[model samples]
Target: MTCSACHQGLPADARFCPACGTPAAPGAGRPVPAAPGLPLPEDKRKPVTVLFCDMVGSTALSGALDPETLRTLTLRWFGLMSAEIEARGGTPEKFIGDAVMAVFGVPHVHEDDARRALAAALGIREALKRFNAELERTLGLRIGIRIGVNTGQVVAGSDATARQALVSGETVNVAARLEQNAGPGEILIGPQTLSAAGPTVAVEEAGPLALKGKTDRVPAYRLLALGADDPELLRRFDIAFVGRRTELARLAEETHAARRGTRLLHLAGEAGTGKTRLLREWRTRATGPGHLVHGAGRCRGYGDHGSLAPLADAVRTVLAEAPRSADGHQDDIALGVLAAGLLDDGTPNVPLEEMCAALATVLARTARTCRPVLVLDDWHWAPPPLVRAVELLHIRLGDAPVLLVCAGRPGGAAPPATAIPLRLEGLDRAEAARLAADLIGAPRTPVAARLLERAEGNPLYLEQLLLPADAGTPALPDDELPPTLQALLGARIGALDPAERFVLDIACVVGREFDPAELARLAATAPGTAAPPDGDEPPTVLPVLQRLRRRRLVEPVGTGPRSPYRFAGGLVQEVAYASLSKRTKAERHEQAARLPSVTQAGDAAVGGHLERACRLR
Candidate 1:
């Protein structure tokens, strides 16, 4: 054998150049293995980035060019693309006719696999541009290609060719679909790719695209440039951060204490109440001085069912930043324990106590050098083992200068003993109105006021209500609120008593505000009125309305005979109405049409309800 590097002849079994001392390339001096059947090695679950690139006009090119000419062009094209992919440390998996597929984090895994795949994709774009220019000049033809990049967990293995490949999963499928969906000469990327690339790679918001074979649309972006945005890759709500001064001040004080020694703080709030945003704002403000090691992790409601998922994420972040820490020994030990306990690609089967002790010891050791701040978001979704890990971290690192901030919806495992609880509520009326104006780009109008009323000061509610479809002049449109809010409110309503839910459903039809007298009269007189399906007599309307009032689904708006009860907010009414089937809605609306209040609103109101009811099949 001869060395590829120095062209020196070597023995048959040599692994390195004896004279030149250059190690041979991987798998050199080894016998080729027999073809493995269907499954291949490296067929385990792990995070990976897949990239697909396709020629735009292969059929036309094939028809126009001679077979020999087309074959030459295809080979040259594949060579150019393969070089780019390999240059960025990716494996060019295979070629399918006019398309080339490459994958990163298989055969071997890299921390920056996603970034590598993305870089390779961008590199291919430049190479293709240069190739097309040269082809146009030399061959009197110009060609275009579209590329798609995605990062996900895939079952990666070789196919029948004995080639290293992504054998199965929706990850590679999504990448192919994304490539097909891309515009000519455009590069599109999935959400995971964008996230792993961080904010360093500037990307234009391409919105969501409905890729084939996927039940739901995938969020995608177009690669623009390479530089981070101001706040990094975190979700930019575009709505100004408003009405969190007090919470920020409290967090600042707690963080200051943490800098001195161990301090744990919990930022608790309901969904859409600005927990994550407030955390980000504080991160930007607290990034200087004694805060040297800052790592954050979050628990997801989906795709994070593993034990210690949040802690694993946080440990990975710490290891990624460990080289900057002054205490190299502590960093090494911490990273070693973390990687072994939870960070490895395989599922860990360690005892909960052992995992906690390892994490706490590492965290304590690292905190002594520079103040280490760990932020754990969405702790409500964290498993019991992870929650125990947080407590253990506090117990072991109590004297270390480490700050642990956790945020989530309330009522899970209790937080650490030393942790201070900071509860976040909705914005006030004036602040919410100001935020609406800022988002809508207009002065406060009656429409904005109505929207604010419906939103009930919830920031997410306000922002969603102002999205293009729901945004209208003079009033908030009578349409379905955002799906996120619908799901959230649905879960809440699902917890209510069936009888209470039934009363609330009818009240929704009676309009936002209703008198019990009217609701009861309508229910009694409505066609096909029946007792409760459970064989129990229906409860009186006034008592049920009072129970709903206590539940905050409805509120008593007036004293006697007038509008005694109104929905807690317009959104509450809308969600309740939306949850009902068409037939039920029509029946409720028909019953409501008989109310004297509806008659008082005049023929238009009564006619509207009756017409809507009639339209139902």
Candidate 2:
């Protein structure tokens, strides 16, 4: 057989052309074969969220329309659906007949891939509504689609680098089954996806489903609208706010300074470290007679929202709250234009400088009457244009009583040089224990202690760990960490570059703590490992390790090159270790057993590694 598009030779069973990635004729479902002597890309085993969308009653609709019209309509539907998926950081993996399969957390994994997938599914529903309206007007036809979203482990790979269907395993199969099981216009999601998406998603239990090819029934949920309850608000009002008194005091100082002059403060921490909580607490305190206008905006991980999205959100908040001028209808119009321009749909009507100038005008006007507090969350995702616009706005304010604050994960775009920086570490043991005690309603209990130990001072981890207890499952098993927490940590590890991930995988196998020299030795000796750069004297692992350190994945145990390093948290180590393939784990363990450090420890230590490795193999 041959590919009609490119005239490239193809295997009879090939589903896509290896030369041009064109799908084979209708009903050709096998994967394309790789070129001889060229190894296929290694399969990645990780947690991914899969979305399956299928048009309802396609066979009937096809019978009503000619083949060409049906093809055109199907292509239009695919384009709209693909846009929705891509906008939310998902890959539209393939189109099968009138069905679409999309996956999130492939190629790049965000900590919120499950949430992104859910959002994309919702977006698709809304988009379809508009598309249906257009179809009804233009062609007197409307279509409905059923969507199923599932989150679980999948072996993801591509036949080639070009975009192609990449995910496989039970996860994909279950997702497809979910779509088939759903009623038209309904969205069904598996339990794991629901859990990983966090509480912001509103869902109703769909009961257990006996899916095809599965021995056990799979629990499912019908996705409702995304909840409006702010997660930070939930934490603030529900969870006891312990620790961080000093950080709050520092923010108070900044607020006071802002009353006298412009102030910029940046709050940085790892995921689940309570950066958002701190901002909420400070915002609550900062609002009063003196501070009149306050607004907060968060950057999203999905969609092609313009660089100024967060700013737009803040501006909208300000416009809503800022007292409408008795004679300032014109001012309202200007502010409204400014807010609309910040939207993601298109370019701002005015030049960026002009927009910044208008923003400065509003802030200055609001500052004259009362202080304006603008909090931009997730500044790490801020693009350069937004950053530049912010700097320009700051300079243009000229000491107006405006306070600008940003909160985001560490290692993101740095704040302006003049901005004050506050870094949040995990809560101390006392605080963590108190938080756990409050959540579980028990003090000094064994479960509480275990929870505190595992949480390692991260407030988010502690909160997630106690979710099962809240749901009436009181037993806290040592081996079973919450899938939500696992997905969160796993996404972080999965985001690492190939070289960094390889070294980190080895480090996970080498125990939580390993010497730099020992890690380099293992990386250099690992089987089938990529060779180090030519003329690179020492192994390249050290630099990769440093990069990981900067990202807060690992930290130094002590000073100096010889000082050992360990994963920042036990959970991080567990997630990284869990992500490694069994074969790779066996290889790394065997390699570690031969290291000089293992030999010095004794024959028993070496024997342990070899024994575990042998068992794994």
Candidate 3:
């Protein structure tokens, strides 16, 4: 017989293409050959540990890089995974495209299938650390993997026609479920597998949680550390000022408690108040050996037609490392479903609740061995379905160490008291001053106090205020500056021609990160009179941002002249944007929002430019 994708030699009774590793579905290119001695359905029997491995943050990885680069990176990632799986005496069942399904004690029995699965997961984690560092420096990318394990009786089969370690039973489903529950860099195991494996990594009883699609509540645990806590283990966030100490300690206490068996933990705070920062820090401290599944949701605003942004980000992250092709020619089909559902955006498709449920099922199985970290940020503005899903997940994962930490504006439906609440308020005068001194590298004296006061002791405001103006004592005023933070931010807001102010408004709307190209194009068509800047050269409007930055209003991203700027105080930015004239604000917002995202050049947003443009017309 021959393979469908590639003409490769293979036995007539083969389940997978020997050369291309694709399914040998009949009528395409291959014929199924029968063996007279093949066991009847009842005669088939085998015992093996099913293993599931997937990438974390795979889709978003495409956003930061080009396709060609992503391809190379993907290959390297899978190469490492393939090597580890093979060395552990495991059968690489099939590639799932950015995910891999492998089995142990299949085709042959190992005395310690459970132990081997655990060993394989650990090996992959260790190999990935060095791999991730290099990738971070070269491609500026970060990736993680999750694994699930379960062992049970199975129908080991050679269809009267095909073969290749096909095992069908409840075990395979259980294993997939455990893997689905795992966090990035964590592994999950069912009762049968966990009991057999014994302790290699620290194990915490995660209690029991209801597995989706199944009526029974599956017992689970969370993997906290490979061994004991090691201070020497360097963390990514620690190297940058991005993670603040306050945020870390605030979330860590509850998280550490969760590892000891507390199930529900909620983190609440304002945007840019470092809620995500704390979550990252807590995750770094919490990851160990068992199931540490994590998922996040971020809310959408304005031009964004709402989203399950956090779940999408988390699922993509966890599945980023799945295998694309088994033999380098054909694609894995199960992974195709995930890719089409996740990465493909043009279809106007609303994903099935079942699909997310299935993914969660896999996550639960994957994370069954440890407490999972489910961090949701900016949840106040999340789509309604996402909120409902989260509520359901908490009840289902009640038995698992699935700590739910969230960051967003306050005063939503009140959370339970057991949910840890962290409120991020504006800094006190001294704390704000320390931050000003840290960012500016200049000592803050009584003179800086007035500046902090005007900014209302807002750290973001303080940082922006410290930016140097071109001339003496900066271009901003001291004489009765705008009163509140919004007014203070608006002090220099009215100065620019309509175009520059329009640009600022968009920057404020887009949050902390944005692309200058999009901002520029939006400026061109807005107000109708604004013209496209000549050449590919960056518009001279950079000076507007420069002036804004110096006045401690805008903060330049990327340190490039053409780089976009963002409001230092997101609160101020939000309030200022709200204060604009409806028609005037709508005109500029409509025009600027018309442009595609920097990475999504061809796929214009739905009803994008037309809808906004129509408002003005």
Rank order (by lDDT, best first):
2, 1, 3
Please give, for residues 1-617, the per-residue lDDT of candidate 2 as tens digits: 33433323356578775544456775333333322211223555678899999999999998999999999999998999988888776888888889999988775556777888988899999999999999999889999999999988776652323476477889899899999899999999988787777677888878588899999788888999876435564453466678899999988888887777788878888878888888777777764457457788876544556657788778677767877555564466657657567643423668888877788877787765567788888776665566677787787787788988888776555576666888889999988888878777776664556667779999888888777543312344766666677777876765554566677777888888988877877776667545455765436456777889987899999988678899888898888777767787888899899999899999999999999899999
Q: TM-score for each prediction?
A: 0.53, 0.85, 0.35
Per-residue lDDT of model 3, residues 493-526, tens digit only: 4323233444566575444556666655544444
Error of 2 at 551 (Å): 1.4
lDDT over C-alpha atoms for residue 465 of model 3: 48
Candidate 3, number of clashes: 50
Badly placed stretches (over 4 Å) of model 3 are 1-247, 260-266, 280-297, 304-306, 321-356, 368-372, 411-420, 443-447, 470-474, 479-617
For each candidate, how many residue pairs have backbone atoms clashing (under 3 Å)? 1, 0, 50
Question: Which residue window of length 10 is worst by lDDT in model 2?
Answer: 32-41
Question: Where in model 2 is the C-alpha error above 4 Å?
Answer: 1-42, 137-140, 158-162, 233-236, 287-289, 319-348, 443-449, 469-477, 530-540
The Cα local distance difference test for each model comes to 0.68, 0.75, 0.54
Candidate 1: tens digits of C-alpha lDDT, residues 227-297: 63222242345656788899988887877777667888888876678888888787777754664566787
Better of 1 and 3 by lDDT: 1
lDDT of 1 at 58: 90
For candidate 3, the 10 contiguous residues with the lowest summed lDDT are 33-42
Q: What's model 3's overall lDDT? A: 0.54
